[model samples]
Target: MRNMLITGGAGFIGSNFCHYWAEKYPQDKVVVLDLLTYAGHRENIQSLENSTSFAFIQGDIGDQALVEKLFTEHQINCVIHFAAESHVDRSILGPDAFLQTNIMGTHTLLKVAKKFWLDAGVANHHFHHVSTDEVYGSLTEDAPAFTESTPFAPNSPYSASKAASDHLVRAYHHTYGLNVTTSNCSNNYGPYQDSEKLIPLIIQNILQGKALPIYGDGKNIRDWLYVEDHCRAIDLILHKGKIGEVYNVGGENEWRNIDIVNLICAKVDAAVVASPELLVRYPHTPCATSGDAKSLITYVKDRPGHDRRYAIDPGKCHAELGYHPVESFESGIVKTIHWLLHNQRETVNQ
Candidate 1:
């Protein structure tokens, strides 16, 4: 059984992955390291705290000494690096944190892994870096989906920092033979996601009757992947991926920003109509008072350097690793809305 060190395990996609891994491989030891940043919450992984195979540590990934200590103590044989300052708007406002965490933090992890796993002659260790598709920049409507060979053209500080980290991972593999693999995925949506993101934000706002803000004309497109599907892809990669190679993971589900908001409104309205108890729980919602959730839509100026479109071609991952996403947007969004409805108290307080 593998002893895995998962960074950013308290955050959105990371927490989901932690649960997925722990449940799927009960014999393996799963250790989570997280800084509990604004987007990271303890409650996300609270259920796994009592599991025999699970452990949680509140810490920074960039702390070399702490990392080394964990490596020695846990006998960590695999590193799934997911920690980062991921919000594009946050990065635009404050880029220093992104650089420090995404670039420097990743470098520190590489150094510690090289010393303990490579220099110390440990065998069968692997490093998997999780990244995003924004590094490929904007794509015109007519442009084909981004392939593995697409050149980097990051337009925002967040994407740029991720791109830098991606290069570092590649350099570590080719230059130092660190036995690394990277997967750059498209937009992910599911339970436990931060409310600041588009999907969760819309859900939360609709529940509270707050404005559903759309950026620009809300025509920007993004390929969406369900969080569990992403975790499954990573599982396949860790087990079957070629070392030193990069794979693109996507759901092949594309939706425009405005369209996603509208869909959520319709779905939430339908839920409220079917279950009147939801009206008691979220009394302020438009649907609670015979008003349509769509009435809350409001358009605002777009953020600077906002990419027009992003889509991933997962052909290589499918052909080589037998990876395919099972959740369609219709079903995935339904699950997400249902989760938020049940967890409204905890989700809104956060």
Candidate 2:
């Protein structure tokens, strides 16, 4: 059985991956290392605590001592590195944290992995780095989607830092012979996401009858991927992907920002109508009180260096690894809404 270390396992995508992995590979040992930052919540992985094969450690990936300890204790042979300062707005406000965490932290992990796995002559270890599509920068309305070979043209501090980490992973493989694979994914939206993200923020604001803020004209587009599909893609990569290769994982479901907000509003409205109990739970919602949730849409100034569009071409992954997203945007959003509705108290507290 594979003994794995999953960094940022308390964060949205990471936590979802942890749950998916634990369920699918119960015989394997899973160790989670997270810094418990603003976005990472212990509640996300509390359910996994009861499992005998799972362990959670509250720590930073940059802490070399702590990382080494875990690797030694757990006999970690596979690492799914996901811990990074991921918010673009936060990165714009404070770029230093992004550099420290994304670049330095990744380097530290690479160092530890090399020492323990390569220096020790372990031939079965793998390091998989999770990254974002923003590293390819913006695309014009009709430009082709970003492929694995897309040159890095990162626009913001966040994407730039991610690009740096991606390069470090690649360098570790080519120069040091580290068995590594990287997957750069599109915008992911699903359960357990922090309220700061667009989809979860919109859903929470609609439930509270707060203004739904849209940046610029909200025409900027992003390809949305269901988190579970991403987990599955990574699963395939771990088992079958070529070493030292990069895969672009995406749902291929592109939607404009305003259009997504409108869709969520409509879906929430329909949900409240279908289940009257939701009206009682979220009485402040415009949808619950004979008003459309769309009435609360509010436009605001756009952030600096905001990319106009990002889409991913998953053709390589499909042809090579048979990777395809199973959830449609509609179904994924519905699942996210339903999850937030039941877990609103926990979500708001987070």
Candidate 3:
């Protein structure tokens, strides 16, 4: 692969992919372009800053001029388009930013990549668009996972925007014959993820004795994939995937919202007994010795258009791409809980 330009490389999945690619291709030059939105933190890539092959730029991917300049200067042959407005609740509050970043930004990237691919000389080009399964709308309790042929039925503004971007990617490939591959993955949870998400938010609250907020009895189900495993799937698709095809990446680890939170609380409670502060609390209050984080859970109203259940089959990726998650959710969540407990010094929500 030639120069790889990964947009939103500082965000959760994008950042994880950046580190993964940087470590995997030590000699290949990788550049990251991020808008530094609330969800992104440059400090996430602190360890990789010293590598000459990796470069970081604080900018929006929607900037046409800057995008063109990067394509020209870096001779970027691969585009891992990850920049987008991802928060479903936030999108409900404010959709303009989502349309601007998710839809318009993708248009800008496709325009630039098309030019390069059409004029490609002794180089291969690909734009791998990262997306979510929410684009398939809410699945019923007995419904099967979404496949590549699943008709787009986005509900929330976030999924709608992502669907628009996915359409744009497909159009570029069909109309202009630009090499592009798309992946719609399920919910991802792991280390270095923003605290606003489900797992990290619950983990942070339990550590500080704060109320863990659950939406609408917390029965909504989501298939969780380890971020690193998602990164590996993206890598396989980028190299071996056929042009103009869509892939679904998931670990098949499905759990209800409250169930996952309760499991995390039990794990954290057992681990917190080893903590110095919690040991002191146990001596003062005999009942508190239980260290039950589950006591803090409080359910609230659900957001508008909440998808009840989403389970990705990932059979296409597994069979065609030979892509399967290496880390099970059990092992992944254990490691995630421990990382949060160790990094509890930060009161950061970033």
RMSD of each: 1.0, 1.2, 2.5
On residues 92-204, what C-alpha lDDT tens digit does candidate 1 reach at each position? 99999999999999999999999999999987899999999999999998899999899999999999999999999999999989999999999999999998999999999
lDDT assessment of candidate 3: 0.86
Clashes in predicted model 3: 0
Q: Which pairs clash in the backbone of model 1? A: none
TM-score sort, best first: 1, 2, 3
Sorted on lDDT, highest at the top, how do the candidates line up?
A: 2, 1, 3
State candidate 1's TM-score: 0.98
Model 2 global lDDT (CA atoms, 0 to 1): 0.94
Instruction: Please provide, for model 2 over 1-350, each residue's C-alpha lDDT reduced to its tens digit, 9 standing for 90 to 100.
Output: 89999999999999999999988989999999999999999999999999989999999999999999999999999999999999999999999999999999999999999999999999999999999999999999999999988899999999999999999999999999999999999999998898899999998999889999999999999999999999999999999999999999999899999999999999998988788788887888897779999999999999888899999999999999999999999999999899988887554533
| Global lDDT scores for all candidate models | 0.94, 0.94, 0.86
